[model samples]
Target chain A: MFDWLFRYANPARFMGLSGALLPWLWSAALLTLATALYLGFSAPPDYQQGRTVLILFIHVPAAIMATNVYACMVVASLFSLINRHILADVAARTAAPLGAIFTLLALITGSLWGKPMWGTWWVWDGRLTSTLVQFFLYLGYIALWNAIEDETRAARICAVLALVGAVNIPIIKFSVDWWATLHQGESIMSGNLAGPFLVPFLVMMLFYMLLFVCLWLTRIRTLILERRLRSLMGAA
Target chain B: MNFDLSPYGAFIWPAYAVSALLLGGLTLWAMARWRAVKAKLATLEKT
Candidate 1:
């Protein structure tokens, strides 16, 4: 199984496989997003939050993916640092901007939801503060990657940054529980979400996850091709 | 569905609109960049 899996570790094989998978991943993303949107907007307003809760359909998943993608980057960075895998470096580098985008979306949407509900555009609550820190970590990771010209050196430095930054992930996760904050804790995990809201939320999560996977694969494939072209040019 | 949008409509509408614009814009930008990169690679491969 490991041998078969590692076969695609080669850039050419990975590109071929990803090329074949892209269309299907894209189709799944579109279909699920359509279904999620239909269910999200059509659902009845919450008894407490009214229509504002609809924002969670997008916000929650973006927030989840923001942290999860960062975690993935850290792991990929570790592989690049330890094993010196070029592919892992490419994966970590490509994922940073995407993760940052999701983190931004999460913060923007969360603030949008908060204004009406919390009566403020921004708050320095525990969850909010920790999430802000997470966003900064993403930005810092990207900046670190860009600051260095040597690919291997950049990957190693960024990997260290990513590892150090991993500490924020747990803080972000538990901030609500650890501190007195206006921001609410997990709705689904803690069973605070109702059946009516949960279905659409789950669907939206699936949609967003599919979208992330599709984007990640495409970005990694492009990076691989770029490196291949650069080496070919050098050889010529 | 029948709730009055007059009160919070300004805030809600713009939020949704901005999100849509950003997400759509980013999607287009990524795809365009991918295509451009692929074209460059193809040219290099040909040489």
Candidate 2:
């Protein structure tokens, strides 16, 4: 199982595989988004949240992707640190900005949802604050990559940071349940959401995952190309 | 299909709009970067 995966550690091979998979990933992302939108809009407004419930389609998915991408980066960082792989560092490096954007979207959408539901644009509750910390960690990760001019040194340092920051992911996940917070706990997985609401949420979640993979592949390809170009310039 | 968002329209539309703007903007930025790198790689390879 892992043998096939290890073979793609070669940059050229990884590039070719990603190139082949890109079209299918993009198509799935678009299809899932369209289905999510169709289902989300067609469902009747919630009795309590009203049309504001539609915001969940975007918010929930963004939140999930926010944490999910970080986990991906941590795994990549592990590969970079333990295996001493450049491509793994590139994978971790490229993922930071995208994860930050998703976290930002989650914060914004959550704020918007909160304004209507909780009558406040922002709150410093455990869940929201933990998520805000997650966003900052992403920024810090990206900044660490840029702040150092030495690529190898930066990769090592950033890999350590990524490992340390892995602690926040679990905190963000359980923050709602661990403390009394304005944010609601896991409604979808807990079977609290109605079928009409659940379907779109699930579809949107799929769309988010597909979208992240598509973007991550594209970003990693770009990084690889950039690295190749740099080496060529050095040779020239 | 339905434009009757009514009272919550103000909140809902802006939320989706912000999401679209952020996600779309990030997508465009990533694609632009990818294209730039690809073009640079092509030029280097040609040389």
Candidate that would win on TM-score: 2
User: Which ten residues in a row are the worst by lDDT in model 1 chain A?
Assistant: A184-193
Interface RMSD, all candidates in order, equals 2.6, 1.0
- Residue pairs that clash (backbone atoms under 3 angstroms), model 2: none
Please give, for residues B1-47, the per-residue lDDT of candidate 1 as tens digits.
Answer: 34444455655666667666766676777788789889998777677
C-alpha TM-scores of all predictions = 0.89, 0.91
For every prediction, compared with the true complex, DockQ reads 0.43, 0.83
Question: Which candidate leads the pack in DockQ?
Answer: 2
Candidate 1 residues A118-138, lDDT tens each? 778786666567778888988
Native contact fraction of candidate 2? 0.87
